[model samples]
Each structure stands twice: as C-alpha cells, then as structure tokens.
Target: MASVQHPFPPLLSQDSADIERWLLALNDVYASDEVALIRKACEFAAPLYHDEVDVTGASLLQHALGSASILIGLHMDHETIAATALHAVPNHLQDWREVLTTRFGANVTRLVAGISDMERLRHFSELREAAIADKQEAAQQVEGLRKMLLAMVEDIRVVLIKLAERTQTLRNLSSASPDTQQHIAQETRSIFGPLANRLGVWQLKWELEDLSLRYLEPLLYKKVAKLLDERRVDREKYIADIVAQLQSALAAQGIKGEVNGRPKHIHSIINKMKRKQMEFSELYDIRAVRVQVKDVENCYAALSVVHELWPAIHSEFDDYIANPKPNGYQSLHTAVLGPRDLAVEVQIRTPQMHHDSELGVAAHWRYKENKQSESGFDEKIAWLRQILAWKAELADSGEMKEQFKNELLQDRVYVFTPQGKVIDLPKGATPVDFAYVVHTDLGHRTRGAKLDGSIAPLNTKLQTGQRVEILTAKQGGPSRDWLSPKLGFLQSARSRAKVRHWFSEQNVDDSIAQGRALLDRELVRVGVTDINQEKLAQKLKFNKLDDLLASLGRGEITPRRVSLAIGQEAPVNAPRASTQTIATSDGNVVIEGVGNLVSRTAKCCSPTKGDEIIGYVTRDRGITIHRRDCPFMQRVPEEREDRLLEARWVAKTN
Candidate 1:
C-alpha cells in the first residue's frame, strides 16, 4: 500500500491555519451544498486565525478546538460550534455587528449578539444587589433569559457551545493578571460552574473548581498541590502494594475478585486534618483498596481472605454488607496490616457495588448510573436533586461553587440508630445534630444521648457506625448549654433557629410588659391624670391613650422630665411657676431667732413678714429679709424654733 502525506506549516508561518483545519474536518461529514457552507464558515472564522491579533498565542487554535471537543462530547452540532467561535470573536475596537454580519449570515450573528448583550451588562454591583434583595425577580430573570435563548433557537447546543468558548477565553485571559484571573474565576464559580454542575457536567465543574481555587486561594491551592505531589509516589506505591496483596490473598482462597485503589484528594486530606485536629502524619484511611467480586458470598469470602492475610483491626472493621448507609453506599470495609506491617484499608463488594461506589450522586443525575444495587439509595437520591438544585442555583449563589467544591473535598462518616437505620453525616457531626435529624421535637427535648448503649453528652461527636440513642424528658426542652460555640453548630438551620426562637419570644413579651409599667408611673407624677392625658394624647394624634402611656411608660419620656421639657418651651410672659410652692407640705419652718427681717418679708421667697422668720446674713450685704418658715431659711436653722418669726410678702414689684 502506498502512504499519502499531508503537508502542514508551523504556527510561525501558517496563515489561516485554524480555518484550514476546521474546513478539512468539516469536509469529512458534509455533502457538496453543505461543504459550500463550511467554506463560507471558514471565511467567517478566518480573521480569528490571524498571526498577531486573535492568533497572538500559538495555543489559540488548540484551545478553540479543544472547547469544540467538549461541546461535541456534550452532544452539540456544527451550527453550535460555528456560533460559538463567532461568539468569542472580539469587536471591542471595531463595529462588532457589521463585522459579524459581513462574515456569517444573521443566525450566527444573532446568537453571538445575545451573549454579547449579557456580557456587556453595565453596573455589575447594582444588578448583583438587586438580585440579592429580590431573589424571585432574579430567578425569574434567569429563567426568562434561559427560556428566551431556548425559544429563540430550539437548539440549546449553540448557547452551551458559546458558553464553553467564553470559559476557554477566560482560562486564556487568566494568565494576563491576577486581577483578571480572579474576576474570571469568580464569574465562572458564581455563574458558569453552578450551571454546569446542576446540569451534571462534572468534567467542566471540576476544572472550574480547580481553576477558581487556584486564583481565589492561591496559597491554599499550592499548599494542597505541593502536599499531594510530595506524597504522590509513596501513595501510589503503598496503595498498589496493598491492592496486589489483597488480590493475591483472594485468589489463593479460591475467590475471584478485581482489585483497585484510590488515594484521597489533597482537599480531603487537608479537611480531615482540620476537622479531626490531627497532624498530617496522623491521617488514617488516606489510601483505600477495593475488591469487587461476584456476589454477597464472594464479597465475604474476599473479606475473610483479606483478614487471614493481614491481622484485621477489629475496631475499624465495617460490615456494610449486612447494613448499608442510607445513601446506598454498600461494602465490607476493614483495616488490616499489609506487607511490612503497614496499615491498609480494604473494601469488598460485588461488581454492581463497584459501579455504585463510583457513581454515588450520579445515580439520579444520569439515568445510566441507576442500576439495581444492594443499597436502596438510588430512589431517595432522586428526591434530593430538587433540594440540591436550589442549593446550587439560588441559596447563597456565590458560595454555590465553593460549597459544592467543599462538599466534594470533605470526608463523610456513616453512623446508625438503635433501629438499624443508617445516618450519614459530615465526619464531626454530634449527637444533637443527629437528634435534630431524627425529629424536631426530639432535638428540642434532647437532654443527653447514649452512644453504642453507653451514656454520652449531647455534644458527643459521633463515630462511623456507632449507634446513637437520644435521651429526652417530658418537661425538658433544649438547654442553652446545647448552643455551644466550642462543641459545634447543629448544622440544621431549622434546628438552630427553633432554639433561638423560643428564647426570643420570651424576651419580647417581658420587654413589652416592663416598658408599660415604667412609662405609666411617669405620667402619674404630673397632675395630668390618666383620663386627662388620654384627651391630650388624642389631640397629639395618638391612636389611643395607651399609646401615649406606653410611650411614656417605656421611659421614652418621664412626667417630671416632661415638666422641664414643657417649661423650656413656654414663653417668658406665661405663668411659668406653679401656683403652690412645690415643697414638702408643712406650714412651720425650722429657723433661729431674727425678728427684724421677719417683720418685713423678703420679696425673694414671698414669705409673710409675720411668719416664722430667720435671718441669713449675706457677705458684705446685711440682713436679707425672709420668712423663717421659708425652705431656704429653714435649711440653715437658728437657735430656737419658738423665736423663729414669720414674714409676709409685700407686693413690691407690681
């Protein structure tokens, strides 16, 4: 056979190289009339292949083609890719419409225009704030736009492909500046990543998380990467040896099984360290091995073989073959001493179980992963998709990707209840959290708990497979003690809010009653009786007298304080002083002997001249006349009460 060779040019000299490649690939599938369209599309995409502008990077063509591969893998068509490449075509320095229309006909032009409008969104802050303030409106807008795009062209392939192109451009622009990287990653994490994850596009979701994590927490990302990289060779070797030993042991026991291994991701290892407060050296279960076999009989046979080969750790042995997690995770897990006495964990399951283990959450997402399994979780998982969808789409949107990333990166522990029901929680979940998960009533009344038939505190952190039994009382409710900053937050937001709600309702009632009494006393001090005050308050536009009373009752105003308040506002000519002298009532004043000043009363106090009088001689001013009974005169008393003379006021000023 003769070999045919095609000539290719280096990127340095290849003019229209990308367009040429696209046409060649398109030529394979299309007929003559369609081939004419492919040539036209090449002419349209030609400018993007230029050496200096869009073609600045040698990798540009590869990135665009790679993005196209992702779209095609996701089930997109040529029309979609054609629209997508046009979508990324920049028109910042030129009239974008004329350029787009001049190249591809209006179909590609219109789709690109819609994406361009969304990207050209002005006042990013205001739009973000509005979305936050009115989530329903924002949700409506999201669905509306999505529907519009779908309705405009019944081909969703085009928009997805365009979005994929945008994602690639973002990845390219990331290296330009840290700020650019951060902005692009934030957009992807907030918007694109969640959208992709919801649609079950895990390949895109994972790349987006890693890229976002790289820029968002660069140090953390690098630390994790470095830690993983450092341990990579040893980890690979350890798991490989463990798997090899397990398979050999199983084969010798006449049990056929397939063995494989997986190492924990860096994020998961870091999380376990943070959660359990352990040094990196103390991490257990960092590497795990799986033995997949024929049936439940072989599964146990493999387990027995594993146990015989290595000394089994009784405490770490998990018999999920008998009881599986609620999420349908089923397997026989056991930790044992492998070659050289190294601690190695082994999991035994059937081929069906092996598939379930890999496709845990995807059992419901893509229907293909939903095969019949020993664990009955696939049915329950379908129900969770709606709940998880909101979590991905709405509730705290910017954190959606981070939360998803963390959930993936964090470790899980499976626990159990007295009745053999399985409960899966985060590694450090406590009994109170479990109590809440059981029932709201039980959570509120939970005073203590019993773990594995032994008494434990409500805050006791549950270990995997430990049976929890909560102790409650008829009269008891949640203690303030349960809301511990140290123990852990009961992760159920409903549970936490219910506990707070009980305390808040009590405080509100107490404050209202206490405020009323304090304010009522204030109004009584003033001679404006409660009845008269009602009339005054009505004139003041209070809906009812209690409103005025309550306002006063609340210490917001005082009756004595009101006197000073009213007096300060009155005119100078008004009778500002009260008619009666406002002092402790008694006619007799305590004063000493001084008759001359008592005979002619002092004008200052309006004291009667003949009234009980006393003389208070002033500095360099003699014999200021006053009634002895006057309060100020009485304040500085003289020798005899009998000699204290009275003074009467003479109308001097008038």
Candidate 2:
C-alpha cells in the first residue's frame, strides 16, 4: 500500500534557538515564573505543531512565535502571550482543552478557545466579501463584523491575540500564493486593521495597514514607498534637525520636554493623499515631529517655543487639547515653515496624551467608522481600550487578568446569516427576531431555523457568533404566537412590532369580511338589497366601504343602526334595546337605565372620558367600565352579556 499523503505540509525541524530568543524578548517584562510558564507553553506547542505549516507556508510553531512576538510588542500580559503560542493547539491536539487547562491554567485555556472561536470567522469573512456586491453594503457588513469580533470574545485580550496573529500572518504573507495573499490582505485591510485601530494598538495597526496595502495595492504601495525613500535620507535629516532645534528652544525656555521625529506610514500617506486630494509633497505631515511634555502647561509652552522658532501656518493649526477628538485623542497639531522654508508639521502634547493617542482608544476608530456620537457599545469599547492602556502598569498587580475577563457589549448579540452577513440584535434575541431583522418578509415566512447547522426552535435565544439559517415558507405570514410576550419568540421591539403589524393587518382584512357579511344580512332583512354600499358608507360617515365594514365587524356599529341609516324601518322581530341616554352631573360615565351605582375604569382597558364605554358588572366592585373596542371586552362570554350595560361619557358643562 502507498503511503497516504497528509493534507497539510510536512512539519519542519524544531529550532531551540527560536524558542530561546522568544523568551529572551519577554524576560524584561515577565517575572521568572511567568516566563517559565510561557516557555513551557511554547515547548508544549513545538512538537504538536511539528512540520505543520499555515496558509503562509510557515511552520505553525514559527507562526505562533511570530504572533506572540507581536503581542509582546503591544506589551500584553503573560497569559496573552502564552495563549498566542498555543492558539493552534485545538487544531493539532484533540485533548487540547484539558491539556491546556491542566498545564497552563484556565485563563490561558479560555484565551486559546477564544482565538479558536474567532478563527472560524475567517471563512465567513471570505463569504461576506464575495456575497456583497454593493460597496456601501460591503462597508456596513465589515463594520458589523468588526463589532461581532469584539462582542464574541469574553476576554478583550483574545482580540489582541487575534490582531497579533493577523499581523504575523501579514508579515509572512510573501510566501503564500498570489490568490491567498490577496484574500488575506483584503481581509486584514477591511477587518483586522480597523479592529487594531479601534483598540488603539497603533503598533500592530500601522504594520497591519502597511503590509496589507503592500499586497492589496502593490503599485500604489510601491509608489508611496519610493516617494518616501527618494527623500528618506533628507527627510530624516530634516526631522532630526528640527527635533534638535525644538529641544534646544524648549530647553532655553526652561521647559522640560522630549522631542522626536515621527515616522510617516505609507498607508496613512496614501489615505491623506486620497482624502484631501493632495499630492505627497503637498501634505504637511510627511516630515513631522512630536513633542511630549510633563503637563498641559508644558504642552502649551512647547507649542509656543516651536511657533517662535518657525513661522506658523495659521490655517494648519488644530487645538485638539482644548477640543479633543471624539475618541479622546488630545494633542496640539500645527504646521510651521522650517529651515529652507519647508513645511514641517509638529504635534505637542503631554505624556499622558501621547500614551492615549498611541495606545488608548484614539481617533483611528472614529476616523475609520465615521460615526459622530459614541454609542453604548463604543463606551464599553472605550473602557476596554483603557484597560489595554493600563495593562502594563497593572501587570504586577494581577488586576489585568480580572479586567481582561470583564465582558462588554453584553446588551447586544451578533449573529451571522447563512450568507455570512452579520446581524446585530438585542441580547436574548431569538431566531425569529434575527429573521425579522434581516427582512420583514423573511420574518413573516419564517417557519423554522437552524442555528450553527442544527435545528433550533424559533424562540431559541440566539447567541453571538452563531450562524442562523431561517427556514422560510414560500408564502405565509407571521404566527400570532410570536406576539405573545411569554413565548420568548421575539426580544427586539422592532421585530415584535413587525409581528404585531402583520397580525393587525390580518385582523383588519378579517374584520372587513365579517362586516360585509353582517351588512349584507341586514340589507336583505330590511328589503334594501339593491342599495349601493359606497353611498351607504358615505351616509354612515365612513370614507371607505371597507372602513365601514371593519367598523361593523368590530361591533363598533350595530346592524340596527345601519338599517336606520339606510332609511329602513326597524323590524319588530329585532331585539329592542334601551335607547335612553343618561347625563351625569360630574361629567362622568352615564349608564343607560342605571344610576347611583359606583363605577370604576377597568385597569385592563383604562377607559377614560370621551371613550365609548361598556360597564362589566363585577360581583363586589359595582361596575368595571371598559372601552367598547377593548380586546377583553370583545372576548366577553355571551352569558355575561346580560350583566353588561350601555354607557357613555358625558362632557362637563362650562
């Protein structure tokens, strides 16, 4: 028998030096025990990932190490690093869960599980890209997917790990096939890059964007790169000279600050060029420097020194410190004419502002999302970003772990359609609610649903990340049971309203039919079968025949009244009800042929003044008045009809 070929690539030989270097990179931040735990995780993953290569044709172990390194650059905690190292364990090891939990601990296991859960979304991302034809629709789907990714994980660190893994994959994407490269690059640019930007992980965000652009728009990427390289040496020299000049000026003024040249990213350059429709040379921020001060006072002092050193471009200044960006980014941005009359952009801010702009929820998310106000979810995201910003400082206190597990956006659940589109709903939303959200027609025809490939009840509370496939009929309407509050069929108000509207429409049609039947019977009995219904409806003060019929069917109009309106004498055989009217002295209800009896508005219907009312005689409580059209009143049994009495509201005299 021939040897069976495995679907995956052969495992590459292990390298001990690679493991040593990875641990060495973390030695400064992690204590010895923590480092040892991370080392053990790497060692455990090494043999398991033996010879198996990822899509990029890199060994799984190398890929894991690369991802871990990215997270380390983000200053993530030890558990995040370890989880990154073991992210692929579930794919290679069946007992991975128990093994990871037993050896590495529960937190690491949970993080690995989260990574694995997120990995499943890759196929959906591809599907979404292929399914959406409209650019605007595709953009909306991408935004939903980004939120879904965040809402899916309990630990925000899992998202950081996922971002790190994507960054690493892009780093080694050159080895992949052309088609694979394009797909990966596009996904990174659309999804992961924005996620990184939102998390304020500028370290990974910049690399992700630059690398993705390098593949997605190769020609443009090279053009920007070449333009920057052509002036690389000169720009570096110019920025360095400006930085030294600013440092000297600030020092001379006795203001303590640190000045450094800021590297311009190719993607951002391209973005600005396209956004402002300006050439690379016209961009003011291409050769930029940042000044970090100790306090707000020092920030203004540094800004003053920079402006005094170079003539300021009044139009190019932004006082973000006083009026910060929506994402909590605070900095003073200004453009000044530097040496040789070159435009030099400078940003001045305190250290805290600098940290926030780089590692907190800065302007990147708002810039990409293009949303003006912060939603509840965005508020929670801000909290998550704060945790990341404080992770390093809180690492020794062990509070980072607790903070990492704090679930956010729990009020919303994000589910996927069969076609891979993400649908966001309120938490506890059911499959029926999902259907309604997708389309009202779909919701009306929805008969069953399959959640994650298995049949689930229509009322099954959908969870985040589940792929829901609604089984719809060819022709149908929604069920009344969906409107029942106790059934849990719908949790969203929008969906519930849709179901109610469907039923109300059906009821209106039925009422019209019933009204027509009753009116026809009355017309025949009164010997006026030849009368025109349209004219009769107009005589009865109804704008439409259907409206007249609906009123009659709903018992809002009596057959005797219709006969009288049509100029027919009442038949002696017809039941003779009291026609007496009683006016109350206090502008309260007046029951015909009844007086001196206590009456109270029914709480169920709350019939108020000016409402057509009916008195339902209770045993102890004199009479419970209800609206004539109230649902409960309509359902009153025939045996109780004798106890009911005609009632009307009498307006008070001025």
Candidate 2 per-residue lDDT, tens place, 96-204, comes to 8998999999989999999888888766777777877899898777767776777777767788788878877887899899999999998888878767766666666
Worst 10 residues of 2 by lDDT: 1-10
Off by over 4 Å in 1: 1-15, 18-43, 48-63, 72-80, 89-174, 249-279, 282-285, 288-654
- Give each model's clash number: 19, 3
TM-score of model number 2: 0.71
lDDT of 1 by residue, 31-68 (tens): 45544653665455546654433322425445555455
Error of 1 at 268 (Å): 4.7
lDDT of 1: 0.53
